[model samples]
Target: MRVDLFDFDLPADRIALRPASPRDSARMLVVRPDGLADRTMLDLADALRPGDCLVFNDTRVIPAQLEGRRGDAKIGATLHKREGPRDWRAFIRNAKRLRDGDSVDFGAGVSAIASDRGEDGSWRLSFDGDEPVELLLERAGRMPLPPYLAGKRPTDARDAEDYQTMFARKAGAVAAPTASLHFTPRLMERLAAAGIGHETLTLHVGAGTFLPVKADDTDDHRMHAEWGRIDAATAERLNAVKARGGRLIAAGTTSLRLLESAARADGTIAPFEGDTAIFITPGYRFRAIDGLVTNFHLPKSTLFMLVSALMGLETMQAVYAHAIAAQYRFYSYGDGSLLLPA
Candidate 1:
């Protein structure tokens, strides 16, 4: 399908620069088969049935954005994927200034040698240190905010906490699973009292998520690989939920993509570990998840395409129209939507 088909006009002011206070206070648009309803994140329990399970991504965002210099030349890098204990593949801001085998020095005693530029133009960088790379990042890296937000303002200490979800534990992701940012302890308590179960998996969301789709057609767009994991126990429990006639609702696109990657043709989810570059588009049949709770996405983005595939293209277009007119926020720090197709 033509990528232009997914384009929509969004007022600049509609983009959220910061998240709603008290997390759960953020508005949620419930997209049902028949119509749309405006609600809050707190109403999630009421929107879902007791037998439904909400799948969440627990991958923690790392301070992956780095500003450094090589021989007085300024350079910026955003680490996307871990190639080894000390090696990471990163997208460079001033890539033309550096070359393979060139060493870039990041302040605070952190530095790396660039090598093996990929077909996508990202370079493989191997850090120079005996200490764990995580520690090195702590001293020199900044949170990798989405380019849309970063372009508007600078990242600050508030974003350190705001960008992370309460479920964050296993660290690796460069980008936060923004939809999960709306969850809070109080919300979880309410969900439990309502008998709505929740489970977690890991998908280290990469900086690639912020990349724009420059392709004229959906078929030409390529998705970047991100690491994810699903344990056997979790898989068994998820399968049981389906067997007992319960719906599996993904908390974000990250969780949905990982679930779909692990799903068998028969719709059974199995244990999985490794990278997934799954590109969901319209006409694709979903097997693992029954519904999705996700943030508003960019125009002509792969995420919009994924949602369009989940619901119909026309349905999603209508959904966005309602969201925009209603003044719901947009992008990573924006409001969310609960998509339940009939």
Candidate 2:
């Protein structure tokens, strides 16, 4: 399908620079096959049945954004994936200034050597010294905010806490799973009290999520791989939910993609570990998840294409139109939508 088919006009002001004071206070637009309705994140329990399970990504965001210099040239890098104990694949800003085997000093005694530029133009960087790279990042890196928000305002201490979800534990992700940002302790209590079960998996969201689809057609667009994991116990439990006639609700596109990657043609989810570059587009049949709770996405983005595949192209267009006209927020720090196709 033409990528232009997913394009939509969004007013600049609709982008959310900050989250709602109380996380659950953020508005949620419920998109059903028949129509749309306005609601809040707090209403999630009411929107879902008692038997349903909400799947969340437990991957924590790391300080992957780094600024450095090589000689006189300034360089910026966003670490997307872990290649080894000290090696990472990073997308470089001002990449032309550096070359394979060139070392860039990131200040504070931290530096890395760039090597093996990939087909996508990202470079494989091996950090110097024996101290864990995580420690090096702590001293020098900043949270990798989505460009949509970063381009507007600088990342600050507030974003350190706001960009991460309550479920964050296993650290690796360069980007936050935005849909999970709306969750809070109070909301979790309410969900549990309402008998809505919840589970977690890990998908280290990469900076690739922020990349734009420059392709003219969906077929030409390539998705960058991200690491994810699903344990046997979790897979058994998720399968049980389906066996007992319960719906599996993915909390974000990250969770949905990982779940789909682990699911078989027969709809059974298996234990999985490793990278997934699953690119979901229209005409794709979903096997694992019954519904999705996700943030408003960018125009012509792969995320929008995923949602369009989940519901229908026309249905999502209308849903997005309603969201825009209703003044709902957009992007990573934005409002969310509960998409339940009939």
Candidate 2: how large is its RMSD?
0.7
Task: List candidate 2 stretches off by more than 4 Å.
Answer: none
Candidate models: Cα lDDT each:
0.95, 0.95
lDDT of 1 by residue, 1-342 (tens): 999999999999999999999899999999999888899999999999998999999999999999999887899999999999999999998999998899999999999999999999999999997999999999999999998899899999999999999999999999999999999999999999998999999999998898999999999999999999999999999999999999999999999999999999999999999999999999898999999999999999999999999999999999999899999999999999999988
Clashing pairs in 1: none
- Model 1, position 241, has a per-residue lDDT of 97
Residues 220-323, model 2: lDDT tens digits: 99999999999999999999999999999999999999999999999999999999999999999999999999999989999999999999998999899999
Backbone clash pairs for candidate 2 read: none
True-structure lDDT of candidate 1: 0.95
Task: Tell me the TM-score of each prediction against the true structure.
Answer: 0.99, 0.99
Q: Per-residue error at 93 for model 1, in Å?
A: 1.2
Clashes of 1: 0
Candidate 1 stretches with Cα past 4 Å from truth are: none
